[model samples]
Target: MRWRARVKQLLLVGIGTAIGFNGVAVAVAPGRMQTAYGIDDPTPDLTVLLRHRAVMLALIGAVVVVSAWRPPLRPTARVVAAVSMTSFVLFAFGTGVNAAQQRVAIADMVLLVALATATALPDEPRPAARP
Candidate 1:
């Protein structure tokens, strides 16, 4: 039980941090993000769109991080994380696999597995009642 809790905590924090950092990077430096993602034809309109997507990703990350210790929010956080990660994974694959794209897809795949495992674990046991 202790180990389960620790695993859950670690997954939540790690996934949230990774996602949030990516969001910040995309939002703050779209050109750099494009380069990193192997995008070569970035326009002003695309940058705005990417920034908006980054905001959404950042919000999701924030929710996951905050919900880690909040039992009430756990289910929703897990659901959102699963959906977002799954979507990203699918998108990465659909975009076709160059070396760079394969790296992104693989990372997302690992994150998705971690999120699923964390979500599947039973909730923490409540404290015993007084006599």
Candidate 2:
């Protein structure tokens, strides 16, 4: 495989780890907001938000893993991964603008940008479609 492909493979692995680990963390420990994120009464909102996040992250991780394992559907998986990354940006940026989640917002922006970039590389065509 080309060096570029290797790089993408590593990036996919990294992002997959990020997504899966973060998913489990948010689900199991949506910790105190005042200390962690500076948000008050974070539990209720965090519950709903983390649940959504966990689902998205789990899906994103699956996409990354699948893409890295095989070229087939990699393009479409990349697009879906990009959408997931973009969704993080949407919430994070909005939180930063209106809700003052500065750190998480910035982090989310950076991670999303990285994931999107990693997934944008060219890949072989997907395997033959089934009926």
Which one wins on lDDT?
1
- The worst-scoring run of ten residues by lDDT in candidate 2 lies at 31-40
Q: How would you encode candidate 1's per-residue C-alpha lDDT over 13-87 as one tens digit per residue?
A: 888877777787888888665554666777888778878888888888888888778868888988887788888
lDDT of 2 by residue, 61-111 (tens): 777777787777567766776677677667767655434456655666666
Cα lDDT of candidate 1 equals 0.79
- Scanning candidate 1 in windows of ten residues, the lowest lDDT window is 31-40
Q: After superposition, which runs of candidate 2 have C-alpha atoms over 4 Å from their true positions?
A: 32-49, 95-100, 124-131
Give me the displacement of residue 71 in model 2, in angstroms. Answer: 1.8
> Which ranges of candidate 1 are over 4 A from the true structure?
128-131
- What is candidate 1's TM-score against the reference? 0.86
